[model samples]
Target: VPKGVILTHHNFISNVRTCVAMFDITSRDTVLSFLPLSHVLERMVMFAYLYAGTTIAFAESIEAVAQNLIEIKPNIMVSVPRVFEKIYARVMDNILNSSSLKRRIFFWAYRVGKKYAARQLQGEKIPASLKLKRQIAHKLVFSKIIERTGGRVRFFISGGAPLAKDIAEFFYAIGLIIYEGYGLTETAPVLAVNRPGALKFGSVGRPIPEVEIKFAPDGEILARGPNVMKGYYKKEAETREAFEGGWFHTGDIGYLDEDGFLVITDRKKDIIVTSGGKNVAPQAIENLLKTSSYISTVVVLGDRRKFLSALVVPNFEKLETLAREKGWHYTERKELINKPETVDLIKSEIDRACTGLASYERVKRIALLDHDFEIEKGEITPTLKVRRTAIENRYRELIDSLYREESSVSSDDFPSEESK
Candidate 1:
C-alpha cells in the first residue's frame, strides 16, 4: 500500500536550497519540466528552479518532448531512465535498418566518439589529433543525433530510476550529458547526484550535504537528515517501522564505491536467491537486456528455482522488420513471436547482452510474449517499473512450465525457449 508523507514547508525549502546550490542553477538557465508537478522530485526541483529565477517550460506531453525541446531549447531537463532507453533503442533500430555503407560510417564515428569520451571521463587531456577526429565525428554522425535534443541541452538530470551505464556513455559520446541521481519522495527526493566537474557514468554522485547515508547489514540504504519526512501521513505503525532505528529505511540495496559514489545493486525485496543459494540482483540484468534494440521490456526470474528464466516482450516493430528481411511468415502477433526464426533471434539477443554475466546470473530460459507488459494488467507500474510479483502471479503456469521443461532437458544442453 502507498502511504502519504507528512512533509512540511521546511522540507521543500531545505531541499530546494540544497538543489539550487548543488546544481549551480542560475537565472539565465531555462529548464524543461516533463514529469508531473505532483511528483515530489518535480515539485522540489521546480521550487529550486524558481528560487534561482530559472525559466521553466512545461512539455505538452511525454510524446511531445522532442518537439518541445526544439522549441524551448532549454539549458537543462530532468527525466527517468525510460526516456533515455527509448531514444537509444530508436536510434539503434534506425541504424540497423540503414544501408550497409551508412552503418559502417556510423560505427566508425561511434568508436572515435567513445574513445574520446573515455579519455575525457578519466581526466586525460585530449591530444590535438584525437580532438580533431572527435570534431569530425561530431559533424559526420553525432551532430544529427544531437539535433534531436535542440543542440543546446547543457545537461540532463535523471532520477526516479537508475540510468543504465551503457545509455549514459552513449549519450556522452553523442555530446549529451546525463547526470543520474538517486532519491525517494520521503527524503524530499534529492540524495546524491552527479554534477558538472564531478562526473561518473555508472554511479550516483556523493550524498548531498544535507543528507546522511548508511547501510544496513543486508545492504539496504538508510538515510537520516533534516530533509527526511516526519512520518507517513496517518500511518503511525508504518512510520515507526520505517524508522525503526531512527533512520528512514530506503529499501534499496546499494553500496558506496571506492570513490564514495553510490552504486545501486537492486531493491532489497527484489533480490532473488536461487535454489543453489546464489543471490542475484535482477534489475542490473534486466537493465542490461533492455539495452538491446530487440527487447521492449523484460523481467528476470528464478526465485528458489534451478536456473534463471525470463519473460520477454519483443520490440515488435524491429521484430517484424527482421521477419520481413529473413522471409519469415506470420499472420498475427502471436504467430509472429512463436516462429522459430523469431525465437532464435530473441534468444541470440539475450545471450549477446548477458555474455559478461556469471553462469548463474544469466538467463537460462525464456518465454516470449507478443504484447508488452501493460499498466492496466498490473504487470508494470505507471513509471514502467516491472511489478514482478504481479507478473509472476499472472503467468505462474507459463513460468513453472519453463522450469519443468528445464528439469527434463539434459544439463549439457544449453538454454530453452517458450512462447506465450
Candidate 2:
C-alpha cells in the first residue's frame, strides 16, 4: 500500500500528490509539519517532503504551531479553514478591543480595502484614488496581521470547509495568497484548487493540473482523473453508485464558470424542494445567515413543505453583549433564547439578513436552540460540520412544534413531536 510517515490518514494520498505537484519541494526546502499524521493532508505533505529529501520539523502540538512557525518560517503551509478563521478573528477582535479612535480607523480602512478587493475580483477597473487608498491600508493595517502569521508564509491553502470570501479577500488585500480548494475523502482528495497567481474570490479556482470535472444533468459534479480513488473499501454497491459512466459521481451540485472554475452551489441531497417544487439551496441561505455576527449556525428545512424555516443558534457572546446593552434581564443561555423579546430580536435579524434571498429561500419562521450544537451530542461531525440528518432527527419534535399553528409555547416547552 502507498503510505506516508507523517500526519493522520484522512486524505493522505491526495495531500501527498498536492505537495508534489504544487510546491515542488526539493532536498534544500524545509517544511514545518504539525498536522496529525493520521490525517491524509499532513501525511501526504510529510511523505512528499521525504521523497523530495526536504527537512521536516514536526511541531510538538497544535498549541506549538505558532512558536514553531516563527522558528521554522516555512515556504508553504496547508491548514484547515478554522486555523485561518481564528487568525482573522483574533486580529479583528484585537482591533475591536483597541481604543475607539484606532478601532474606527482600522474598520474604515478594512471596509474600503475590502470593497476595493471585491471590485478587483470582479475585474472592474479600479480608480486611481481607491487603488492608492488600498495600498495605504495594506501598509498600515493588513501587513501587520500578515507578519503575525510568521511573515514567511508564501501561500496558505484552506480546505475542509468553505473559506468565507471576505476572509480570502482580506488576506489577498494584505498580500497573502490564501488559496481555496475542494476535495473529498474518497477522491484521494485534491481535485480542484485556486492556483497561486490565478485566483478568484468567490470561485474555488479551476480543476487542478490533472483532474477532469463534469456536471451531471441534475447539476451534481462528476470527477475523473488519476487522483480519483479506486473504490470504497468494502462497499461494492456504494462504489458502483458513486461512479457513473466512468466519472466519479460527486454528490455535490455545482457549475463550472466560463473560465473553468468550479463554483459549488450545495449538496444535491441537501436541496430543499418546496411544495411548489421550487429547489432551494440551503447552504447559500445558511452562508448568508452566518454573515451576521450574531448567528453561529442555521439549518434550513422545507423539503416537501410550503415554505422554508430554520433553527438558528446564536453567537452567545454577542447575544449576551446585546442583552446587556439593551438592558434585558435574562443571563442564562436557555432563559435568554426562550425570552419573547430575544426571539423577536433574532427574528428581525433573520428577516434583515434574508431580505435579498429568493422568496422561497427566505426563512419564513425560525426557532432558536438553547445550546450550540456539538459533535459530542452527535449533532455535528468531528470536523465540526453539521450532521443535517442527525439535526433533523434530534429536533423533529421542536421543528414540528414551530410549524404548528396553534402552538404558542417556546422551543423548550414543546413536546417531542417525533413521527412514527
Pick the TM-score winner: 1
Best by lDDT: 1
TM-score of each: 0.94, 0.81
lDDT of model 1 at residue 336? 82
Q: What is the C-alpha RMSD of each candidate to the true structure, in Å?
A: 2.3, 5.2
Question: How many residue pairs clash per model?
Answer: 0, 14
lDDT of 1: 0.87
The stretch of ten residues in a row with the least summed lDDT in candidate 2 is 411-420
Query: Residue-wise lDDT of candidate 1 within 124-166, one digit each (tens)?
Result: 9999999998999999999999888888888999988778999
The digit string of per-residue lDDT tens for model 2 on 1-420 reads 222222234345545666576756677666777666755455555678877887778877766877777788776777776566556655765776689998887887888777787677678999999988888887888777766766777787776667777678877766677888887766656778887556887777888766789888999999987667767666677778888698989899999998888988888888889889999988777766776656777788888877778888877877787788889897577778877677777776777878867777877777787677886898875455678898999988777765666244332232212221
Q: Which stretches of candidate 2 lie over 4 Å from their true place?
A: 1-15, 24-39, 49-76, 82-100, 111-132, 406-420
Indicate the TM-score of model 1: 0.94
